[model samples]
Target: MEDRKQALVSRLLQYALIHEVLGIPYNEIVIKRTFEGKPYLECSKVGVEFPNFNFNVSHHGDYVAIASEPLCLVGVDVVCCTEPEKEPVPEFIENFSSYFSSLEWDNIINTGTSDEILVDFYRYWCLKEAFVKAVGSGLAYGVDKVEFHHTNWTNISVKVDGEPLTEWRFWLFKLPERHWVAVARGHPRFATENYKRTICKAEFDAEEYHKGLNLPNVAFVTRIIEQLIPVSHGEERPTMQDICSDCLHLSSREA
Candidate 1:
């Protein structure tokens, strides 16, 4: 019952946000999931033609987040910090060192506190997950192949196999309740290839994607459950959005 409720609410959030963004009726909105479970909006039928208009959702601990882009493929991830009780922090994190690059691993261990170390580990993990998800790959991605470089989790960049991927963008936030959230945006070619194998492929142009200079920044907006609930009688309400229109909008509430 709990799982079903969670699933139902997730659908409600997805549909509500899609409706808000596309300004179209729910009947006309078509969201098809990849075999890997990444939900994408089918904008062609509605005459909305953004080459890589896509979104991704993630939930952890006490929050659910959705990140969308009109030109770039977007992915988001949230993780609650948890410290291991039995194993030493270094030993516990070392076991998963293969998932991170040497530089990333070094930074993760160089932290001063055990708590900081754990947070650092989760931060990188979340970033990697967001990047892969944006690229249309699931968590079972070549995570170690790409490394993130950041300053206090902002002004971030990434390198794949020691070469900078200049087109990619990333943002991170320390959410309420000690959770870390990461958002990633990148080219649609890498995103559409893996997910569209079993579905209707999205039409994306590299030039148009790169030409899309105005990407949205990440926003952690607080919303009530009532807002996510659909209104009856076909009534309508004013749309509430963040200032950075094209970025990720994350709504977090107590579970």
Candidate 2:
């Protein structure tokens, strides 16, 4: 499982760079761990300059999720939603009550159906996990410290230490039929108007990964790059040509 998770992260990192999301080469990218055990990318290990990028990875059951943003903190988590038939719903909630906030506990107990309770349990679990991972504090920053309130499936508000936090944007969606995934990104003014989601499944094979690199979806890559680049005051936004030229120059220098 660990090996598979690492492979998934590596592939996503390569995709981010190859598509000009970070303007760095695959070989130059080095994975480093923070004091809290979160993985991040650096290029200094290979004498290349580090680019502005933040990414997080999580895996469960048979799925792995990766999230990246050019200049903002990003975290992603995937949880297997397959419920075991043997465990009673109440017993399951009781076993995991320590991880839930008081409000979450109330919701789970008040939910009308066992299935609803299970769904709510995983939804809150993924949101909290994604938030902590975004802060790069991992579980050391207690999950109980943060609580999520949803006005709708897509609209959410958060509270940390019981104070409302308005700087984060969250996305929650199901991955095919087997897993639930959540992504969190933080900015003082976060908006979901530009947010997009893509889902794909690939096996962790080095040879296949290398082959896949030669076939990036240009339109999709360009769209993501445009969304990730930050706008500056009184300056024109970058064109796709400008971004591609910069990446080409970097690649030539590396060559």
Candidate 3:
């Protein structure tokens, strides 16, 4: 019940954000999920037209994050760095070791003290989550196949099956509250094509996404629950589809 409640809250926040960004009325904002359960707006059904505008929502600990862009697909994740309560860090991380590449696991374990290791582990986890979310993959996505390559945790790029994905971009930011946030942005068609069995036949303007690379480094401004509440609900709720019509119906294949 608690998990459902939080999910509802996050869903409402997503609706509220779209209202604020695109100037759509709260009652007119329509949201639906992909077969993989990634939320998106069906612009045509919603009476709006924009080229490949996409957004994603995530919440963890005390923060909820949303990343949206018209040029590229975007995913955001927030992870709170907290010590394990039931087991040591190594043990806890071991349970998830299968999700990481051998190289990534080596980097995590070799990193400095226990606290630093915990942070590093969460960083990798956060990045993985962000990438999957960006690509609209659900729980079945093979996180192990997509590996993030970084030098000293900087200059983030991703590789799938040992080949580099040059068009995708990643960024990680540390908050003052021992929390880490990661963002993943990639060309919409490229993002979809890379997903096994998924196809994007629509002509794309890759140049637009690249030209916008001059986009300023965005900083998260805190929005308390109260400030968000007003937009979270509206007098009349619009009908929404359970699954997005615009999303491809491709089934996920194992890596």
Best by lDDT: 1
* lDDT of residue 157 for candidate 1: 91
State candidate 3's TM-score. Answer: 0.81
Please provide, for model 1 over 20-121, each residue's C-alpha lDDT reduced to its tens digit, 9 standing for 90 to 100: 777666555566666566776666643445444567777777677777776666788888887777898889988889999999999999977988999999
Question: Which segments of model 1 are wrong by more than 4 Å?
Answer: 1-5, 196-207, 211-213, 233-255
Give one digit per residue, the lDDT tens place, for model 3 in 179-244.
888988876664544331232222455665575444665877777556655433436644433212
- Model 3 ranges off by over 4 Å: 1-5, 45-49, 191-202, 231-255
Could you tell me the lDDT of residue 139 within candidate 2?
A: 65
Q: Which residue ranges in model 2 land beyond 4 Å of their true spot?
A: 1-20, 44-52, 187-255
Could you tell me the lDDT of residue 31 within candidate 1? Answer: 62
TM-score of 2: 0.65
Q: How far off is residue 230 in model 1, in Å? A: 1.5
Score each candidate by Cα lDDT: 0.70, 0.57, 0.69
lDDT of model 1 at position 132? 87
